[model samples]
Target: MEMFGKTLCVTFDDLVGSGVMSKANYKRYVREEKFSFMQRGGNGRKVLIIYDKLPDKIRTEIDTKNPGAKDKIKKQQINPMDHRLKSDSKAVEFYKKYTPKISLDRQTEYVLNVKVLNAMVALEVSMRDAQGKCGFQNNKEIREKVIALCENLRERYRHTLPKARLMEKYAAYKKYGYAVLVNGNSGNQSARKVGPMEGRLLLKLKRSKFPVYTDMQIFEEFNRIVEERNARATREEDKLKPIASPQTVINYLYKTSIKLWWYGVVHGEIAFKNEFMPQFDTKLPDMPNTLWYGDGTKLNLYYKEYDKKQKRMVARTIDVYEVMDACTEVFLGYSFGAENFLTQYDAYRMALETWKVKPYEIVTDNQGGHKKPEAQYFFKRICHLHKTTIRTTASPKPSKALSDASRCR
Candidate 1:
């Protein structure tokens, strides 16, 4: 017999085991020296024959008997669950389980400022649907009710809500609401309406009770208020405001103004009127070589001197003095010394010899050495010989003279 369109053959042992051909038939076949047989194909019956090796003629006979057996084998059906569909609903379930819910209180405050609660609601619905959860599709009525609640909160608290805080709240609400709705059961009927406190309402409280608060101070206060408020209540109706008075504002303004004025007075302007204003009515007559500016400054200093005998060191100080032409800004004379009048006279003599110029006036600050009677007499005699005059400023403002020289340079 044949099944599945394939010829069937069974061994002698197989025939005995299946109780088809008996032992006598098997023995008879063995004595005849023939071990193979063929059975016709029929209803659910498989025929078996025995052969040491299939002969070419038998193989050809089998192929001829079953024309389309290979095609039948290729056409078998596979199990449906074996292949994975990429766009399956499993991803939606995974996200719904892990994503966080938004704070309702925060969202309500945000809606108050933006006045776009309906758009926020729509966004929430869309996000939920994308998560593979049945969105706000319970009915049009429920959606409208939720949207209306957002609008009501906005209307009631619009004045109290800060624009920036409200915006942050809106974002939080949108995110959390979407997560909650996606994972929550619609039929459980917990009044799909979430309140403001549940939404994590953020407070953009005023920077301070005083008007003079800095940005950092204001932010600190705002954070403090938000944390405090959150700790007390999760409901909008339970929220409280810290009181402030007008007197506080006035006091802050007054104090800030006084501080600013004091700062300006301490750090500003210290210059001669003549130095700043060139067109001042009181102008001094030009003195040419008659007047000069003299000052002393440190070039570089040595604190210790090498000791050759002891192979050690000793301390000493050095000072330098120079007289400059007030108009020409030329260095008239300079001296290095630990002594006074002698150095001054030597520097003067060097100036005359080097520049071949004589000064009509000698101007010097009232240092003990320069103001000595002997020095003054020497300067007067020098000025007389040069046909110049002597003049001196009451105080030495070297910085002003230096600035003038720099501008000319």
Candidate 2:
């Protein structure tokens, strides 16, 4: 920081010394819009520079005391990166052995040569300032000789040529004094680029009624549409770029609409209800014969009857009526007859005759003859006379008695 270097006369090394704050945190502070920093030397050479705010009174006092503190501390070499690189004895060895080697292109090599020249100038200044000189007042012949030492470093380390684009690569480090700034997004990100056409196509495909379609199929359709639309394109660049890979499209669809994909590909409304839909606990009759249920169904088997007119056997069907105990799954009584049908009177007669004890409550479906108003009134009137309650539902849900019977069978 300028305050640390110029006003407080503190080198970066001394400012972060004794655990006042970490160099990493110092760099973070600068990046967080809390303060600003300026590089004194060329940007690559200015890696160590930082500027921290101070109180007005303190700044004035320091300025008075140290009239040219920046010039005085200019002798201090305060590169956290250089410090880290040189801290360990095996740094150079490790860097040489494990670091990736590079062969720069012609354009890259030329720019690096310019950075190398800047490095040479930095080396010369440090060398002269070490001695009793303030300018190029040092011997030009000797200065030039010493400065040339930094030039040949590129040959030793090829990656050293690109003299670190300070703002792009190490801006946070310079501002906040952090030696390591995570460059997580530094590499080529060409694959992650989602163009508008690709996105529109993906949505148009994935969110369609055809969610059952495979991503690859969607991708094919996507290309087809692109071709069709671009047939009218007035410019070459106006044509569509290709959509993402099939897997990527699948992943994107899953993230955006897992429920949509599930409903489309895995399950329908019935499966959804059976799986994720909630159900409430329902209380059942606690004692046997406390409740009675009655219902009728056509038997699956049919018998041949003699037809008087045709003088031949004709197919005839029979209906079954049953009365059940709600709690025990016991079929109390059932009536099926050749001459009898499932009328409301037959239903009432079957139920009244089936149970040995009078039912406290009776359940039946609101269907067929039993659904008539007169039939309902007859049951209610009979139930009232018998001190019983009659309940009927229009929905074809099986009673608990039927459920119990099913479980037993």
TM-score of each: 0.25, 0.34
lDDT of 1 by residue, 95-207 (tens): 33332322454433323333343344554465446433311243443344444444455555452433445445555545533222232332222333222232111111121
Model 2 per-residue lDDT tens digits across residues 44-146: 4432333235435434544565566655555443332121111232322322232122223432443444344445445555655654432224466444444
Model 1 scores what on Cα lDDT? 0.45
lDDT of all the models against the reference? 0.45, 0.49
lDDT of 2 at 240: 70
Q: What's the TM for model 2? A: 0.34
Q: Which segments of model 1 are wrong by more than 4 Å?
A: 1-290, 301-304, 307-317, 384-409
| Each model's Cα RMSD | 31.8, 26.8
Supply every candidate's count of residue pairs whose N, Cα or C atoms clash at under 3 angstroms.
23, 5
